[model samples]
Target: MGFSTTHLIIFLVIIIVIFGTKKLRNIGSDLGGAVKGFKDGMKDGTDRAADASAAPAQQVGTAGTAAKETIDVEAKTKV
Candidate 1:
């Protein structure tokens, strides 16, 4: 069966006794910070992926123009 409210309270009390309130508080804060950092890192990675994909499209657009410009330069240099 699932844990009732009383069982949950008893479990929490045992945990607090094993690890004092101060240590538990610090542990809780550290866990929260880790979760926050992980979320931020995931978001940053997604943004970088989006930027990386966009960059290739722009490079492709420029590549076509660059090839045309290079041919003109070569022709002029020969003349």
Candidate 2:
């Protein structure tokens, strides 16, 4: 089963005893930074989708040709 409230309380108590208050505070800040980074990434992805929707549609053949060129470049670089 997933962690219930009681389980979470017990886990927090153990973490406090093991890590102490100062280390726990640093961990909280680090976790906050990680969450902020994830939010920023999601925002960037959403902006890209919005920009794509606003732009004109490109020809399917044009995209296919560009993709082939990119693959050729990659293949050359690898070798």
Q: Kindly list the per-residue Cα lDDT of model 1 for residues 1-79, writing each as its tens digit.
A: 9999999999999999999999999999999999999999999999999999899889988998898767555557543
- Tens digits of per-residue lDDT, candidate 2, 1-79, equal 7999999999989989999999989989999999999999999999999989766566554787887667455546542
Candidate models: Cα lDDT each: 0.93, 0.86
Top-scoring candidate (TM-score): 1
C-alpha positional error of residue 28 in candidate 1 after TM-score superposition, expressed in Å: 0.7
Clashes of each: 0, 0
Q: What is the lDDT of residue 43 in candidate 1?
A: 100
**Which ten residues in a row are the worst by lDDT in model 2?**
70-79
Cα shift from native, residue 35, model 2 (Å): 0.9
**Residue 10, candidate 2: alpha-carbon lDDT:** 100
